[model samples]
Structures are given as structure tokens and as C-alpha cells.
Target: MISPTLIQAKGLRKGYGQRTVVDGLNLDIREGEVLAIIGPNGAGKSTTLDLLLGLRRPDAGTITYWTTDPSPHVGLQLQSTPFFAGFTAIENLRMFAAFYGKRLKDAQLMEHLHRCGLEEFAKTDALRLSGGQQKRLAIAMTLVHSPKLLFLDEPTAALDPRARRDIRELIRSLADKGTSIVFTSHDMEEVHKLASRLVLIRDGRIIASGSPEELLSQYGTASLEQLYIQLTDEPA
Candidate 1:
């Protein structure tokens, strides 16, 4: 069965000076599903995410969450996650958990690290870790509070193939456990592998949206890459 809607946005519009970024967008983030928002650069994908996350106010729109206080149940992992200078990987997880007002035992903390494949780097300074390790650590930090809804921006960008595969598996596991994930990515293969549904946007408007198979069939395209190219190509 489909899960309940965890967040709803209607007619979201945001702009800077004379330029609009997110224009007349509507979205629904339901529980226990993975939703990917994809688009070319400058297509307002990130702006749409910010509007839905409430990090930026829209010029016109309304956003509603399942609960009145959604922060306790939400997690956000931006592309760049800054860790405290001296905190180790495990320490960062503890600190983030405390931000949500929860204290985790060592076993619990280790479990989070283990899941993200960071247990070996538990005591390593977060900043000292390699780029991919830091990325995984950031994801671990988001899970410390066991949030019901997670927003990941470019979760697997720039990682080596193995790291990317690991992160994909992690996302799949999270969805299996019923966490609603909203992520943005340029990797169509990752999108095809992970997204139960997706929204494709351009110039701040949705151009196409549906499950991978659904959109592919609707457009009569062989794959998502082909569909993306077809829909996003400039008109002659």
C-alpha cells in the first residue's frame, strides 16, 4: 500500500531580483518512498528543494507537514556538511544526535557508523577523512536521530563507483525500513536504481514526472537518459 503524505507543497514560487528560481511548483513527499528531483543546471532543482525544506521562503506558496513540529522528525544532508574541527567521526554523530535532544549509547552510535561503513574511522577526525569517507559520515550524522523524512542533495556525487554503490544500497535499505527520502542527483543510473518516483524540472517548472518505467513508456524512450535528453533539449 502507498504510504501517507508526509509533506505537501502547493504553487511554490521563489525568485531573486527579477529572476524566478522555483516557479509555480507543487510537490508531495509521501512516507516510505524515495523521490528524486532531477534537472539540468540552473533548472531550479536546488531552489525547489530549499523551498520545500523551508530553508528559503517562497515568494508565493504554502507548505504543510504531517506534524506541526517537523524538525524532530526530519533530516537534511546538504552537499557540503561541515564538521567541527576536532570532532571525530563518531563524535560528530553524537553531537548531531544531541542537537535533536537525544543521547545515544556507544552501541547505538557504533551501529550508525557501521551502517555507513565508518566504524573503522570512528576515532578519525571528521575533517581528516577522505572526501568519500566524509560523505558517508555526513549521511551517518543524519541518521542519528532516526528521522522519518530525509532530504539528501547529491548524496552520491563524485564518489568512486564502490562508494556510490554502497550509498545506493544504504538508500535502498532505508526505504525498506520506511524512511521517506527526497534527493537530487544528476546521475540518472542512480536515479533509476533508487527513485521510486521522480520529478524532472526545467526553468523552475516540472517538465515530466513519474516512475522511471512510467515516464520511459509514456515518452516511448528506451531509458531515462534518453528521456531526459529528449525533454531537456533546447528547441530548434
Candidate 2:
């Protein structure tokens, strides 16, 4: 039996006036897997996430979250970690969790804090948290609603080795729990470690896609980084 698609983007097209970002792209992310979109800078990774989240309409395509439930679920972590500066760590979570229209009491909030290793710092003001702490906070907040589909944009772009590993582990745990993930990352090491499948894009179109080992073998490369460079260098 075939499992249902969690998200499908058909002929996705987006642009800022004359400069088109994504051109005739189509992709699908299914339940219980991690699909990482990796490409060169300005390759339209963020734009694709925006369209997929329904934050913006595609100029000529359909982006749908395929669920019978009226309010099909999704959670997003945009390029930056957003939180109210004056609010404490737990406070920040409270605000966003409320926006999700879900009631997460203090006990549950503390549980997430403990899971994120932020229980000691729960009372600290969000603005005062370090960059790694902030990123962890973002991940914890995104998990507040226990969404079916998660969109993460460059989640570890600016973090030390330890923090990066922690976030990647968190993602792995979530995927194991059956939450579909669509993440974009410049860190090939993290991508190779976290993604069940890789979707490579160049100039807004998918140029190559497969498992990390498959793509590496196919492109005669030792790493996903090398495969990415080779693929994006070729003209489609």
C-alpha cells in the first residue's frame, strides 16, 4: 500500500518582477521522512520554503498540504529565530504556542525546556540568550504544536559543533516519530547526517536528487558537497 503525500508542489513558479527565482519546479515530501533541499546561494531554497508554507502564493503552481483535516498542520522556522526580546524563554514559547491555538500548560512547557536543555535558562530573557541558545529555542518553539509537517530553513547556519549536532539529533528524533520534514541547509555534513533523501536545486529547478550515497556514487564524488558543486555547475 502507498502512503499519502504530505506536501506536493506542482509546476511551482515564483519571482520578484523580472528576475524569476524558482522556475517550473515540482516536488513531493511524504510522511515519515526528511527531505533536505541543498543548493548554491540564491538557488531559491528560502523562496521555495516560503511558497510551501503558504506564506506566499506561487505565480503558477499548486502547493498543497494533503490532509483531510480542515486545518492541515505545519510548523515553520524561518531563516531567523523570532522571539519577543523582553520575554523570557518560557514566555516566548507561551506566546507562539498560544498563536497555534493550543493550550500548553507550564508543566508541558517545562517538559520541552528540559528536552531542549534549557530548563536552567527558562527564566532568562529571550533577547539575552546566546545565538546557539536562541536557535535551540526556535526548535523548541516549532515543536510546540506537534505539527505534521515541519519546514526548517538553514537551521544550523550559525552554530558551534556541539549545538549543530544537538539540533540535528533533535530533528532525527522528530522524523523517527513520523513528522515529515523539509529542511534547507548549507552544511553538507548536517544534510548527509539528517536527510533520508536529498533534493538538489540549481537556478530554481531540481537538477539532481537521491540518497547521499547514491548521488555521491552517481557523480563520482566522496561527499554531498562535491556532488552539489558538480550538479549546480552543470547547465540545465
Candidate 3:
């Protein structure tokens, strides 16, 4: 049996005064799947994400959520997660939980911090945490409400190898437990590892999309990096 569609977007278009960011894009996000949107800088990946998450309104398009209570069912983790610099990690989680209209006990909150590998940093101020720890804390904040669908932007960016692996594992674990994810990343290898479906966008348009293996096979390229360069690199 096929999974039900969670989000369906049609003709998604966003633009600034003179430049278009996302143009006539249509996509479907299904339940319990990882969809990775890959692109170079200025390719509208961020804009697409904002539109999907309702952080930004599209100039033209319609987004439909087939599931009830879609608003609370979604969560977002951006490249630079905003937090109170003076607040401890645990305190930040508590604040966000309350914002989401949920009250999490200490034990429950600690469980989430542990999952993100931030248990030891629970008492650490958000400003003092290392880059990876901050990222993990941001991820932990997103889970305060137990969202069914997650939107992550550059989730593993600027992390060391070990930290990157940890974040990747955390994402996999979430997917294993039936959380649908849509993420944008410049890391081709990371995308290949975590994404079941890939969408390539360029200059505000989707140019190619498929599974990693399918894309490699179709482009006759050995890796996603090569295929990405071939697709997006302009000839001099």
C-alpha cells in the first residue's frame, strides 16, 4: 500500500522586487519519507523551505495539507537556530515547549536532550555551546512538540566529521520512528546518505529529481557531487 500525501504544493512562486526566487514549483511530501532538496547558493532552496513551512507567503501557489492539524504537525530547524543566549539548553527547550502550548516534565525534556546528544550540555548556556552542540540543541527544540514532519536547513553544516555523523544518525533515527523530513543541504554526500528522494533546484526552478541511485544512473555519474556540478555549473 502507498503512503498518504502529507503536503502538496502547486505553482509555488516567490520573488523580491526584481528577482524571482522560487518559480512555479510543485512537489509532494509523503508520510514517513526523507526528501532532500539540493542546490547551490542562490538557488531558492531557502525560499522554497520558507514557503512550505509558512514562514513566508508565496506570491502565487496553493499548499494543501491532507492531514488534519497540519499546523502543529510540522517543525522547522534552520541553519542558524535562534535561541536566548543567556538561557541554558534545557531552559530553551522549556520555553519553546511552552510556546507550542505543551508542558514537558523534566524527565521528558531530558530524554529529548539526550537524544540530541545534548544531555551533558543541559545546564550550559546556549551561547557557550559548541557549534555542533548548538545545532543539536536547535534540533531538540524542534521536537518539543513531537512534530510529525520536520524541515531542516543545512542540518549538518559547519560541523566536524564526528558531529556530522551524530546528526545524521539522529535524523535516521527520527525517520525510523516514522517522522517525515524535508531538508536542504549543500553536502552532497550527506544528502546521498540520508535522502530517499532528491530534488535539484536551480535559479528558482526544479531541474532534476530522483533517488540517489536513480539520478546517478540517469546522469551516468559516479556521485551526487559530479551530477550536481554537471547540472548546475555554468559553462565559461
Candidate with top TM-score is 1
Residue lDDT tens for model 1, 1-236: 86799999999999999998888998889988899999999889888888888889999989998999998898889989999889899888899899999999989999999998889999999999999999999999899888899999999987889888998999999999989999999999889999999999998988888999999999999989999999999662
- Over the stretch 1-236, how does candidate 2's per-residue lDDT look in tens digits? 44678878999999999999999999988888799999989999899988887778899998776765513378788878768979999999989898889789999999988777788889999989988788888888888999888889888878788878778888898999998888999888889999988999888999888878888888899888877777777766
lDDT of 3 by residue, 4-117 (tens): 999999999999998999999999998988999998898999899889888899999999887656778888899888898799999999999999899999999999999888
Relative to the true structure, how large is the alpha-carbon lDDT of every model? 0.91, 0.86, 0.91
Query: Which scores higher on lDDT, 1 or 2?
Result: 1
lDDT of 2: 0.86
Candidate 3 deviant stretches above 4 angstroms? 234-236
Q: Which of the two, 2 or 3, has more TM-score?
A: 3
Off by over 4 Å in 1: none
Error of 2 at 107 (Å): 2.3
TM-score, each model? 0.96, 0.94, 0.95
Clashing residue pairs in candidate 3 are none
- Listed per model in order, the count of residue pairs whose N, CA or C atoms clash below 3 Å is 0, 0, 0
